[model samples]
Target: MSKFIIITGGVVSSLGKGISGASIGKLLQLNGLKVNMIKCDPYINVDPGTMSPYQHGEVFVTTDGAEADLDLGHYERFLDVNMTRANTNTAGSIYQTVIDKERRGEYLGATVQVIPHITNEIKRRFTAFENEVDVSIIEIGGTVGDIESLPFLEAARQLRLEKGPKNVICVHVTLVPYIAVAQELKTKPTQHSVNKLREVGIEPSMLICRTEKPLSLHLREKISLFCSVPTQAVIECADAKSIYHVPENFYKQKVDEQIIDLLGLTPKQKVDPKWFEFFDKAMTPSKSVKIAVAGKYSELQDAYKSISEALRHAGMNNDAKVEIVFVNTEKDNVEEKLKTADGILIPGGFGGRGVDGKIATIKYAREHKIPFLGICLGMQCTVIEAARNLCGLHDANSTEFDPTTKDPVVDLTPQQKNVVYKGGTMRLGNYTADLEEGSLARKLYGKDQIVERHRHRYEFNPAYVKQLRDTGLKVSGWHEGVLPEIVERTDHPYFIAVQFHPEFGSRPLRPHPLFDGLIKAGLKRKENK
Candidate 1:
């Protein structure tokens, strides 16, 4: 008897449908209701695991090791819920499941059609996690007219019929374009988008319109009239300075009220507007810090969206404005770039495209006494750079790039008996890391034991630990097992790197410890400067 809300988009894609769905879920949770989120992607890839950052942006890893769409990351950060592999599904996954069942003879020799077979698989994934929570917010990827997304839309439509209209609600997010030359907001696109959605079997219970300007009353009425929704249900999502302001903005638009009324739910707790006050206070800037991020994917901003957000969250926590300067380590003159920033960051990536540049940046940071933070591959590079430059290990290198090194600073797992290929099958997702007492990590976390999400194939070779530490690098944190997880420089002002991606778990309210610590170190550097 759980309620459901399926969110769809039209007129175009990337209209913040995922964020809108997440905001609704957050609002529902704030009203004392247990909510869960699911994502349905139209892509043929089994998952986003094997996709390149340039193609699909970053592949977000869940607590249960699912490499999901980046929208799931937004859902987890907003709702504070740990998503799993079961919560995400794609066209490829659905087809794969059907084919696997056919191969296993579970279909009973019947010829499968798209209607019952494909839609059934999609429906099964949707309802699989339904009973686990009081409400499930399902966001369908792609626009309404996308042929690849038709099966998902059909499945969701049938689910509404099976679950009864009272138990299901459809929320459609569309865009409202404003013409600067004419100086008027147009509603024809939204009307056409609604018409396209109605061409299918589903009618939107609420229309969330993305607009640059405030939605005037006439436009709202026109959209409601053509879209067959109430004027009040036409929620305008005007642009906000920070995405953290979305919940309060939606609340002001009476989005929660419309949802509650549509679902026939009575509130158990009154909605509080004070959370926005807290968020606003946190975002109020008292100072500024500039941090340079050196990485292979510096050309693409979406490649490091989560990391950028984490830095912003740290700034919010400290009531400061963080100015991130993207430094393409692949470019020449890397040292000149490092000299201008307060701190240095090396993010995670695969392959050896710009690794030499990263090593050069790490060398500059270490030699100039700049605060440095590295993650995953960055951590390994830092170790290799330290071994080569500081410890006088001339042949230091990562086994990932140089498999035949006599003194490999970073290497593959000695425990694994076979050569491992990359993609989805890395040491991905959440794992526990025990911090050494009196270390900077422990001080920042305020706890000795912590768990963070990881997405990397290479690990820090523990055999080089003693030698690296003897040369002034401190293995400040490690997994309780034999493998090394985190390493820090004991003598530097603030230099640490981990084999995990803390950016995945960071939120607007709760910033990751490493990012917060890095920003603090940056502020200190700025003060000294």
Candidate 2:
């Protein structure tokens, strides 16, 4: 059976609960344990696919096509483990399942309630991975006092009883706010947060305090006394220069050893030298490069969280610091915004918002010979721009924006035509693309056939494939030679677009080839100038 570690947040939101959970998982992995992390969202939405990026940030699509919370991306990046549909659950999904089961008479005329019914469903999902993993760190979404989180908290509390307290541990993350007037860190909030958790029948085995500075010995002792946790179990997660530094931080604080001692797990191996090397490279880069991201959600960086992290990882691989200049096409002039960039990146997005600006930016990159990398919607915009400016089609556009356009260079895939429900239907997850024999993509990837992840509805319309190919747009890759997956141009130095979110698969140690290629091109363009 897998030992369970439940991480819950309190005092405030956005306290890096996911990062902490991921850091713990990384340490356990170093100890030669097969560890996996799962997320439990308290929201009522069945998935985050229908939520706006502004509200919930990016909807991370797993390889199994699960539209999960963005924290899943952090889990994948840190742990290097591919999550699945079963790794994430929501209140909405749990309720829907229970209600459907009841309607089918699975409960046998028993009255449905939140206690046994909802809590049972939640427990089943969390413990489903016991046979597959040695340790499963489940991060519960939202704060302790949230109404939507009560059932999950109760379920975790009950799980401690069923799994035995020796196999279950709760790590509560709470804020340690500093009072400017008093110039002292307050433990009152932390105390109240822990009190709230205990009131709900869940006592924390560890307390991770989020603060701007290190917790003083007095502060740690105070928290330990009030929260009833040992002084060493009061971990301090001070602000770090990079999220990658967190695992090292936790290791330094002996959090990993503490966790192992409590869980009664013995290490097959003690330390990981590879993680240290990766962290060293991230902290000390040789050079710096500037990349401009042209998008609608430029105002909110979280909307393109994974892309930004991928770029950073690529820069680290090349020993360069990546500085992102967010260009809000709806507000900023596209030409001016992109003129100073070493490379231009158009991240994946939906709707027609700031799309014309993105198209203009793509045209600028193409015409000026600036290195350009386009993602899902970015790829569609590039094709549309090529059809309009290069192929002499003045009104080329996607049906997603202008359904009445005469030249529909980009349209919904035939398979997605009947996907009336907007939640989970799309050409998503991992798919293999056959690369051209002698193309830039194949050269960068060093393979003829590559597998990438997708999160889009529209694809390069096959009817206009010949027309675009006739005008110097090289169709470098395809999915079984039917749907275009990667498109490039031979005339330019580095102009490529992929109808998939390659950023999703990029990692800190091994960057995605596409992003790595773009950063290298950016370096070349910078040196030439």
Candidate 3:
């Protein structure tokens, strides 16, 4: 049987419960324990697929085409593990499954209730991968007192009881706010948070406190006294310059030791603290580069969390510091706004609101000899802009917005089969793309064939390939035998657009090649400036 670590949050939201869970999973992996992470979201959406980026940050896609909560992205980047659709479950999805079964007459004339039917589905999803891995780190979305999250919390509570105390453990992440005037770390918030958890019959075996300042011995003892956890297990998670430092920091706090003791499992391997030394060096490195992200969702920091982390990883690899300038390309005066940036980056997105603005940003990058990197929708827009301005194809547009176009520069893949509808139908997750030899992408990746995560449906139409190439646009990457997946401006300085989201696979320790190349271009641009 697999040991389970259930991570819950209380007091309020945005307490880094997901990060704490991911940190624990990473520590377990360092101990040579095969680990898998799962997230239970309380939202009513079947998944985050149809949700807006403004609402839920980025929708993380899995290998099996599961559009999961953004925390799954954190799980994948932290542990360097490939998760499947089975790893993410939401209340909407669970209830939907149960309702579908009932409609099919599978439940057999019984009045369905949330307790036995809904909670059963939740348990089934949780244990679906029980025998597949050594440890499963499950994170409950939302706070302890949320009305929507009550069913998930109840289901997890029952699972812990059924799985036995030795097999299951709960870690509650709470905030420890520091009052600048008082010059002390407050502990009442944690006490109330733990009291809330206990009221639900789920006493946390450990408390991970997130705070700006380090927890004092007095504060730790106070929390332990009220929360009912040992002082040693009341781990302090101070804000670090980089998230990668979390694993080493938590390990130093004896978090892994506590987990081992609680689960009654033999320690598999010793964690090497030296692995994070390189990351530390990267964080405090001497060299620095500025990369401008011309994205639609720049107002919210979480909007580009994966993309920012990916760039940080690349900077770490190059032993440089990446300074991100969040440029809102949707602004009216975008040209003046992006004038001083070292390099231009257009990330993935949906909808048609800021598309013309994104295309304008792409045109500016191409015309001004700036190094440009485009992802997903950014790639399609680059092709559309290039076709219209450079190739003189005035009618250039994506089928996503103008599906009835007579001369579509971007259109849905005709050869793509088994795609049902718009909600989850896009070619998602990990897909292989063949790069042309002697091209910029091939040289940067150092490989002819590469696989990356994709989250878009519209692609560059091959019908305009000859026209685009004749006008200085190179179709450098393709899928199967036909569809154009990457387009590079032949006449410009390092302008490239890729259909896949390389940010999803990037880690602090392992940077993606595309981001590495973009950072290098940014550094070169800074020197030129």
Top-lDDT structure, candidate number: 2
Who is ahead in lDDT, 2 or 3? 2
Candidate 1: misplaced stretches above 4 Å? 414-423
Query: Which residue pairs overlap in candidate 2's backbone?
Result: none
Q: lDDT for each of the candidates?
A: 0.87, 0.93, 0.85
* Minimal lDDT window, size 10, model 1: 414-423
lDDT of 3 by residue, 438-519 (tens): 8999988899988888888778888888988987888888888677878887687689999988888887777898899988
TM-scores of the models, in the order given: 0.96, 0.99, 0.96
RMSD of 3: 2.0
Model 2: CA > 4 A from native:
none
Q: Which scores higher on TM-score, 1 or 2?
A: 2
User: Distance from true position, residue 193, model 1, in Å?
Assistant: 1.3
lDDT of candidate 2?
0.93
Provide the global lDDT of candidate 3 against the true structure.
Answer: 0.85
Best by TM-score: 2
